[model samples]
Target: MIHFFKQDVSHIALPEKFTYPFHYTPHPLCVLATGEVKEYIAGKKEWQEELATGKMFGVLVVQMPQSTDTGYLAAFSGNLAGKNIHSFFVPPVYDLLQPQGFFKIEEEQISAINQRIDELENSASYLKAKERQKVETAKAQATLNQAKAGLKAAKEARELRRQSSLALSEEEQAGLIRESQYQKAEYKRLEKEWKRQVEELEAEVTRFESEIERMKMERKERSAALQERLFEQFRMLNAKGEVKDLCTIFEETVHKLPPGGAGECALPKLLQYAYFHQLKPLAMAEFWWGDSPKNEVRHHGYYYPSCKGKCEPILQHMLQGLEVDDNPLLDNLHKDTKLEIVFEDEWLLVVNKPAGMLSVPGKADEVDSVYHHLKKLYPNATGPMIVHRLDMATSGLLLVAKTKEVHQHLQEQFEKRSIRKRYVALLDGSLSDIEKTGRISLPLCLNPLDRPRQMVSEEYGKEAITDYQIISVSNGHTRIAFFPLTGRTHQLRMHAAHPKGLGCPIAGDELYGKKAGRLYLHAEYIEFRHPIYGDIICIQKEAEF
Candidate 1:
């Protein structure tokens, strides 16, 4: 559905190209559209609680048909209130929820199969076979044990006869040997008879198991086919009027199959309707509308980028023939910035690394890193001069080793947690709920769906602990000092943003919070025992922020 702007947006200049979707600043028109969509959501009081539990909504600012006016289209990702169709929003690319749809029919078939499988597993015949097998196995073992005991008693009696003092003929000794051989043969026969009886019960159980396995295999195949067919239904359109389904788009990508919830996101839906109805897309923005996810950090009403795992391949095709903004991540901003050395010695040195530079060189062509800069300074430095790493956006002290031996020694200290680290950060929100000083113990792990981004996952995460003390509070922002007891990827950021911890993300944290001019986190202090000098080594640097 197309909704025209109620207020005057004529003074705002239109964007030259569409929003990049992955990383962008919303255009003035897109911002206005976002505000209007928010008001509409608020007007629906019935949906308030559901919306508060987290949902992603997107808006696309478009040029309406045959009119010199600009308007927008709104959509919610996936479904809302157990339904896909709703008022004032674009319809799904493929509505699997429709009663007469093939997806629904096939889904019911699958459900029926599942129910049948359950029935067979719990059937009296199958259960009887399993019980028979168990009872037969135990009887077999007991019979074999009794037969062995009888044979051992017979052998002992034969040994007693041989040990007697009476002088016996060679024929008597031969008779005793023959008796032992006959007894052994009888035991072998008994063992075989019991084995045959036990095997019959096992065979009956195996027959039932084989049928269950066959049904399970069938279930898996049908599920795969249904998923593929569902993906084929999502035929998306581009500005050039080109159409492609989810399967074809993802087949061209590294992942040859569409991920779950691929074509249902708000961005894809909004673009699909715009292209089908001949609306010219100007810019677009997606935002979180409710509570943060359990494992991820998302603030209410905050703008977010379209997820890469699902939408990247689809949007790559949909945005064709439309000019889009340049990706800001690829910008090489370290050309003129200087890498400053704060402390130096023959064994090691400390450098003040600037923000927006990688700790180590990445795959990018022009991006500079602290490791490369350090290597340039110490041309003959031995064995991977960089000792530790900091997040690219974090600015401050970085320890570097001049020799391989020193590097190894320093690395041991880090592994043993002998090194003390302190960081200064500015949290976007005030710390009214938490104490002035406290410890945050939230486990962390990488978010595989969104690489380089970390999440708090108690189920599959490593121990990440941080002790913090508030330095000051002003302008609704809290300046804090963090003392990390364990080194983990994005430990500080996850602790700050996670609901179980401070519940306030670090200021300008693009991965966890809002994107700003720079991330307001700095590695300010480090302490360790010198590898060669056998003395306490301490270094501290102040943050520019």
Candidate 2:
């Protein structure tokens, strides 16, 4: 049963079998255990109309009976002056109608609701328009910037061409020459800027092409589509269509580009194309041929350079290398240590290698290396043999053999896994498992996507095992002792940082861990059988932590 009034707990007894209609929200109101009595605030027109029989602003008291489920519906039909007020007792009813006054209140409520909806719609529209405008504004700005650069370049180029023309009178020609030189300087500056832009574009293209090649080899159609989408924007910039003649156009455009002209050098453009195509073989050949070579051919066995004496002229005139040869890398490493020996003996030598020092010589920069250092130290020897390697960053315990026989013996021991190597590492997070010891059996494989990162894979991977124990923990850092079963490049370090394992990345491993500093892992101990003495030998150095 439903009752309507204002603020009373008492109920008058009423009969049943009567019904009335009422409007209500579908949401249920929580009925207090003690029963709540309140004025029925109606927002529906039918409810308001029912309540309007009485004065509009007067209060209606309600009673929620404590003893029964059904209660009386009474109407006190006049003001409190006792002016012929009518009293009525209605039977218990479930559907009650609203008074006329309540109906009017509902109509106004609906109008307010509609206004709110309109406001919300306007707000939504405004936000959408603002976002669209922002996007368009950014696009317009970018377009303007590009146009400005192109126009400036074109204007400068035209001016230079005009000045270079010989049709002007002598006085005018002198003025033109002066103007041309100034413009030429400006053009060179612009050319440098253009070169920088081209380099950036080339790098971007190279990365894109590398990704594409990787995707193609894996037969990833979706990846290829994504790659094409990224290139679409680039194609618009370059005014390119289809992939055919792309290299040729790029090369020609770059080549025809004068030093300060509106055009760019073709070398970068060609390199970018070759990088994208992974035409490394051809690219390498071109690079080896230097900037210019009159005649060059790659045959089955070797490369042939028949320059028609053009190469000699280039070497003499263009390169200016007649008196001295300059290698920039060597120039960068021009120090006494590059020539001085760290440690040398007739049998073996150890070197304190500075960073950027190669343990052995590469094909190109074959001048400065440990071999060079050793060669300089031992003039009578043929070539020093590198027994093991410490990466350019690692600065201690590099072993080299002077005699071929000794080198072969030392190499055999390393290859046979007869060396006991220990590394000290400062790792991320405090050591939780200081006494715990277990073998990490995850197989290691070089990352196909990023060659520099090694991944743990289940298939097509080689077995890698590292035994690590926490030595000490301090300052949220754990010093760990590492021993490897297999000598994989970056094996122990990679395994330690694996998320499922300890999750404590080695300090100084910027690629694998938070950039704390340099790589904190140091090879502090190496034990092996000595070649000359038929006994085991151990070498240890103080921690460089």
lDDT of each: 0.90, 0.46
What is candidate 2's lDDT per residue for 1-545, written digit by digit as tens? Answer: 13332333334332121110011111111122112211232322443444333221111112232333322222221122222222321111111122343323544454455555455444654446545555655655575567568667766775776678867677875775676567657656765665565555556445545544554444444434433332232221111212322222223332321111111111222222322332220111110111111111111111121121111111122112112223333443623565333455567665545544667775656447776676766776544477887654444556677788878888888888888888777887786754566667767777543334567777766888888877878898888888877877567667777654566667755445543435677777777676787667666664656
Which 10 successive residues of model 1 have the least lDDT summed? 160-169
Q: Pick the candidate with the highest lDDT.
A: 1
In order of appearance, the predictions have TM-scores of 0.93, 0.40
Off by over 4 Å in 1: 65-67, 164-175
Model 2, position 369: C-alpha lDDT score: 70
> How many clashes does the backbone of model 2 have?
26
Candidate 1 Cα deviation (angstroms), residue 108: 0.8
Pairs of colliding residues, candidate 1:
none
Give candidate 1's whole-model lDDT: 0.90
Worst 10 residues of 2 by lDDT: 18-27
In model 1, what is the error at residue 527, expressed in angstroms? 1.1
